[model samples]
Target: MIKASADALVLGAGPGALAIAAALSSENLKVEVLANSDPHEPWPYTYGIWGEEVDDLGLAHLLEHRWKNTVSFFGEGADNPSSKSNIPTPHNRDYGLFDKNKLQHHWLSQCELAKVQWHKGLAQKLDINETESRVTTEEGKTITARLVVDATGYDPVFLKSSESGPVAVQTCYGIVAKFNKPPIAENQFILMDYRCDHLSEKEKSEPPTFLYAMDMGEGSFFLEETSLGLAPPVSIETLRTRLELRLANKDIRITKLEHEELGLFLPMNLPIPDLKQPVLGFGGAAGMVHPASGYMVGGMLRRAPGLAKAIAKKIRDSEASPAQIAQCGWAELWPEDLIRKQALYKFGLEKLMRFSEPQLREFFKGFFDLPSSQWYGFLTNTLTIKELVSAMWKMFVKAPWSVRIGLMGMQGREIKLLWEFMKPKIKN
Candidate 1:
């Protein structure tokens, strides 16, 4: 017989959903986590969990691989990174890498200890009604709950595939690949260097790629940042070809093999995809991505506790949607001509450097407390003016188009004083 009902129904078993279950179960709420797969082993995302979040969630011991410091590499004109401040560590940019499988296993153990319910199957469809909720799976089983959360996240292609699901918030593609030898940096990360931007026309013809990497001590996860004009490989053969020149070259050798790939037209489906049945949206499906950089896990780990709390409170107080993971993702293509994307890029380059650890904590905390913070700080008006000027300056120099795109939309709206406010104003 199909399960009759649940206090809360969580669809998808990724980190966000897991965290939600962990939190809700803690409050003694009857939680059912529907997971389609195990979250271990290498996947499309190299979860670089933030430094403090592990200890905060009491999962610090689960971090099987982590390096303390890092340096960023820029192209020719840009100086080699001097500060390891951005390095993932216990402090500063200190983030820990989840040997994805290890962390998942650890979290799973924790969930088991908590006695949270788990059902395994793919979520097929949901029918929400005025009073109760129902979810039908592909395997001919159904589950219902008072409150339902759609944790399947943003799926641009999937939405196009079925004319269902919400639209995405941006446009991008991503992949995670392992290196043959141990990584180059022992205690650092390599952001996109001139290697990608300075590619020859023939190389460019192949496809533009941006890379982010970490040394797993023995192996590395080379993550490709999604940029404009390219999509992720539709097939493994195409992926091998795209990365063949840069990664699968003569110098690099491969010993172990693992791969995860994803492509997204971020702007394709989002801004609140429809809820089939009184279902709530969570995680990126809730617009949880950091605007300047696309680091989803960091903010996600932080939001889990709160979302769980919200769900509990709603059940207690008889609220309809207790947790509000609002839609705040605001990204369009960095306009080639609009005085927007370029300005945000430059502004973004500066802001990422300016953001302090404590400031970052406060910034994200506010967003969790209230959804508007997601749009307020960076997604404002002053960005527009800066882009207008940035577009004007491009006439003289040929800069990386990526940088230009970042500057204009870094702050979703118009930024009149990005540069003006950088330094303390000169007193009369």
Candidate 2:
């Protein structure tokens, strides 16, 4: 027996799921969200985004703090032993940390205003037909809707998976703590601190890791030690030890532990969903994370409105079939241009996996050396194909000889990947 029905049903209660539910409800669709846990609770992890992205989304007011000085430290300069290699290379862009409580409340308020219904259940099975889909919860309650969207996060429950090669995982362990003194400079955000000054020779020989940090004012700060991408993810324990070492090296001591973020693993370069399936996908389920940078929130926020508009159009169409609606949603999320850009990013990730620690540092040195537009465009997924190619060439020309040789070594695989990317897609 169907316990409930709506115009659209969303599985999962993450920000992505709530965002879409709110948007769809605003479009006059009867939207329902199902999740096992309380959806209104504050998110566990801290989310940071480029300030411009939040401002563009009109969400700047949700930021708890903003830092105008964004810096990255690569290592010590070869020419000047005293100089940390480009220590404090300014990104020239502001960064903001989202106020999770406020952000969640904002989305929840939007959903409430639009009359979106909320249900608490763990979806166990999915049934799809030509007109509507049904999801069965663990307690045997069934809910049906014209379209069902799986926003169930990284390990999707309903979205059909595709064959993918080895995936690299981005792992980090972080903490929010009150320090004996200010750890970082006031209003400073360290985007990537790759310097090994704090690590022992043995630790440095292991897979490279970087420090991601931000100042939260009044001797409180958030610090994370991160492995950008690795096949066998670095363990949380390892990262925790490294974080302690990094702090000790700077003579910084923790006065009180406020929050601990453990085992944050993000899988990158996963295959996009098979768009032929009747059930649509959104958020992590749709492979929306940037392949190289592990960023999704800002992009998801930026893309949500358009996706909502597209889904709403199709849902309102009398003749649109369930499969067609799903296809429309998938295509909107993974358009051809973005698809090609993701392929390029995947290729870059492959190369990064093979880089030695020193080579990795050199690569980023050359990478950041590019015109701010190029590097920024690459990270933000705003560059056209031509611009992306041009950016690669510029980085190659600027890279040190050792780094260039490492890049050259991957030419064979690069050619194969490019060939595969350029191949014509067979439409169903």
How does each model score on lDDT?
A: 0.47, 0.82
Best by TM-score: 2
Distance (Å) between predicted and true CA of 28, model 1? 1.0
Candidate 1 weakest ten by summed lDDT: 325-334
Assess every candidate by TM-score. Answer: 0.60, 0.94
For model 2, name the residue pairs that clash. Answer: 75-85
In Å, residue 325's CA in model 1 sits off its true spot by 13
* lDDT value for model 2: 0.82
The global Cα lDDT (0 to 1) of model 1 is: 0.47
What tens digits encode model 2's per-residue C-alpha lDDT throughout 17-107? Answer: 8877877787878899999988887788888888887887899999999999999888842335457564677899889999999888887
Query: Model 1 over residues 1-428: C-alpha lDDT tens digits?
Result: 22336777777677666666666677677778776875442445556655555666676776765555643433222123334322222222455777677766655666677776778888887665544567787897888776666666654211112123222233333444465654445655553322432334565555334445666544545554443221222333443454444454335655555554554443321223332213565655554444345555655565666666655666664434322211111111111221233333334434333333233323323322322222222332223545434433542133334433433344422253243334312211
